[model samples]
Target: MKRASVAVIPAAGFGTRFLPATKAVPKELLPILHRPAIEFIFDDIVGAQIPESVLITSENKSALAMHFSEAPNLESHLQSNGSEHLLEQHQNLLSNTTIKYAIQDRQLGLGHAVLQAEQLVGDRPFAVLLPDDILLGGSSFLTKMLAVSAQLKGSVLALKRVPPDMISRYGVVSASQIAANQYRIHGIVEKPSIHDAPSDLAVIGRYILPPTIFHILRSTPSGALGEIQLTDGIAKLIESEPVFGLIVEGDHYDVGTPQGMLACALTLGLEHAEMREHLLEIFRKWSQK
Candidate 1:
């Protein structure tokens, strides 16, 4: 299967982890430095040659939809101030990319949120990127997944080896290494105990999935907390076809909590060439104090 030119981002989660902050603002709109986390995902999509994106969001997430929409007033203000560069930068951010929004309405599982985009995705394969999982990169990570999926003609999941103690925090996978940094996924268990974990290779937020999985998810029963688990759907897909895991090379952060959000911002700030020295000085002073 050739890699599809569309990506789906499931951003409808309640984001209960962030509490009051998320109560009024959608978690996807939170800034990771100068850009919102969703923008990072969009950057990856555009780099991967994906021209269209469907954002699956719930109510009160219109702000997220507006972020990609034209801000004529802001553009005018910047242009009138003789800030052509700023105006162009803002316009080019989403240039040549089409963003569509779908309402999940109900708070369901990640699988359910993705299912909402079936019409938008049609019958083609598509990429799924969770905004909460920010991969610090300008490009290449998603491009790699697109390559693997195109070669395998099946699903490719981004995998990372987590500590055994932390395996329970993610969906652990049992797989046989068929190639360097690549595996034939045998099974996947969600949030398993350390003792019952299949393997340390945990699934991250990046995925290139076939349209067939949507049918499986449609009939999939709700699991824990009465939410449909995308892991469960993938596990079922594994039984019928080969699913591979790619050992992604990049820094991954779960920005669902304040601590994680701060970590992402600090890491991005430190990596900025122009801001590196200033961030280092502030870090040095804070550490000494």
Candidate 2:
């Protein structure tokens, strides 16, 4: 089994969900407290000690490119003002991680966006991380998935037990429990209605995919959304190879929606030393009798 050496982050969507705010800024760049949501993605990747990342984004999103690249002018100013820590945080990340961008000219879909990284990723195994999905507790998610992928010698999907009512929001899987917290996924359905869902195990944003996925995606065809669905590709992959679902213990949230984002922010805010007491007091007063 080839160990994944790079992470592929697809950040090219129009983020129609976030609207006007995303009109000016990419959803991935939206602030999660003080840090951009994409920073959280990078934090986990770097934390896992991954050496490279292929960021699949649109050419229109130049901000995404600029955010990762260094600014010598800004660094000089911060140094003179003794506020170097601001730049230092990102500087450390840049030093440890090499980020390469793959241009997805059109906002086709997640599968199409991911396909843009084929040249950069070549034939090696790579992890797919969605910036919109905030996997708190850090790189442990990636580490666990990578380990699972290695053992299975196949693709691994991060699985979570979401409420049954919300099953349609994700690609649900049909799997047999092979071991503790691990399942051998025999089938997967994309956004199936509650009546059709096989199980409550929702496939989350984290994925450890093999390069063969690129070819599958190319011929995956468009779904009802008139776009290539990554879920469909993975489902097809199951026919020829091993695909597993791993349920790792961690706080995972789809912060792409306003409510989800706010909930994540508030939860994270309460965990920070400076905001914990203040946020707790507010929540206490807001609670109903």
**Model 1 Cα lDDT, one tens digit per residue, 74-165:** 87887888887854644565885788989999887888998999999999889999887878754659899888887877899999999978
In model 1, the runs with Cα more than 4 Å from the true position are 87-90
Clashing pairs in 1: none
* TM-score of candidate 2 against the unseen true structure: 0.95
Q: Which stretches of candidate 2 lie over 4 Å from their true place?
A: 284-289
lDDT of 1 at 145: 87
lDDT of 2 by residue, 8-35 (tens): 9998888899998989899888988888
- TM-score of structure candidate 1: 0.95
The CA lDDT of each predicted structure is: 0.86, 0.89
